[model samples]
Target: MSRKASGFTLIELMITVAIVAILAAVALPSYRSYVTRGRIPEATTALASKRVQMEQFYQDNRTYVDAPAGNNDTGTSTYFDFTAAPGGAETRTATGYVLSAVGKNGMTGFTFTVDQSNAKRTVVSGVPGWTDTTVNCWLTKQATSC
Candidate 1:
């Protein structure tokens, strides 16, 4: 025998590239979902803190109407837009109110709500690979209700 080729053939290189592509295709979505879930706690924590603030205001005013206008943000978030609910300047009723967080940036298709009754819920999502239970619960994990 003379000598074997020391370098990879064109076909071998193409096969390696194809394998990498398949791995990436499978991994990218899982990594993206994990990142999304990480950002979600920010919204929930802000909402909880805002709820406490609302309760304090209610204790003093005895009505949710004076709590905060709908345009006033409960708190700041980079990945979420916090609105007092209804996303307008209208005031809520004296006995009840709702606060919601809408996703921003790369977090579209996510909406979370909390009410004066402390009810937490995640709206049905339109995102691919996400399954919303629509059961009046927050989804802290992938397709899992909280």
Candidate 2:
């Protein structure tokens, strides 16, 4: 009489499990890294957008402004939305970019700053309507190079 084969042997099962585990081990980290790299560009775009908004605001207002209200709420607003965007949060100093991003603690981190001497532009934050973290947007002046 013919008999059905038994379940897989221990060695076969172990080999399959090991193969799956190995594949997972390699895939997981690579996936995470890919995601992280993708995010960096989003952040960079956000920052660049902020700089553009600053320039536009300067032209309209004739003065540098900070985190103007309604920029995030309304598309017409000439300000960047760092929180909504990817640069985290940032500001423009009179002589450089004062980019800020919230960190692990209550403390904030400075991403980077482009000094006036190098870019021939002024960047400042903490203006009448601006805050360190909330200063995601900025307004530039007509005469100012931004």
Candidate 3:
């Protein structure tokens, strides 16, 4: 009596592995880009909200200097570090301010900045396919306009 193989043959298994590898090769970068894009709102929202607070503080104190320090909504961000420009310069008090979010961890190589003028800019250097210029453009994975 002859019996048929009950399981996949070596060639069939190899083909399956190859298909999975190909799929992963296509999907992985896309997934990373999506994740990076997701992290951007954390920066933009925080900066915008801080801008409001700074404006309020200016209304009360008549200057941008010594405005209350802004905190990251989560206390600690996973992908970026938020900072206010003109930080702690006792000799000079800023009439205008720039808030920035610098990428961290796996998100390193990008920086987003917003100023009192409400201008937005991105600086991308270490990331591939982007130049080092700090261009006035919205931050995106495509690095378009910059």
Local accuracy of candidate 2 as per-residue lDDT tens digits, 1-146: 99999899999999999999999999986665454334334334444555566566656765443534203322322232233222322434332333322121111222222221223212333332223332223223212122
TM-score of 3: 0.84
Model 1, stretches more than 4 Å misplaced?
1-5, 68-71, 87-91
Query: What is the per-residue lDDT of model 3 for residues 1-146, given as tens digits with 9 covering 90 to 100?
Result: 99877988899999999999999999988887787778778777777777798788878888877676443333567877877743532312557777778888877888887777889988877775445567796676665673
Q: Rate the local accuracy (lDDT) of all candidates.
A: 0.78, 0.38, 0.73
Checking candidate 1 for backbone clashes, the offending pairs are none
Please list the residue runs of candidate 2 whose C-alpha ends up more than 4 Å from where it truly belongs after superposition. Answer: 67-97, 101-146
- Residue pairs whose backbone atoms clash in candidate 2: 57-140, 58-139, 58-140, 58-141, 92-123, 92-124, 93-123, 93-124, 94-123, 94-124
- For each candidate, what TM-score against the reference? 0.83, 0.51, 0.84
Deviation of model 1 at 22, angstroms: 1.5
The top-ranked prediction according to TM-score is: 3
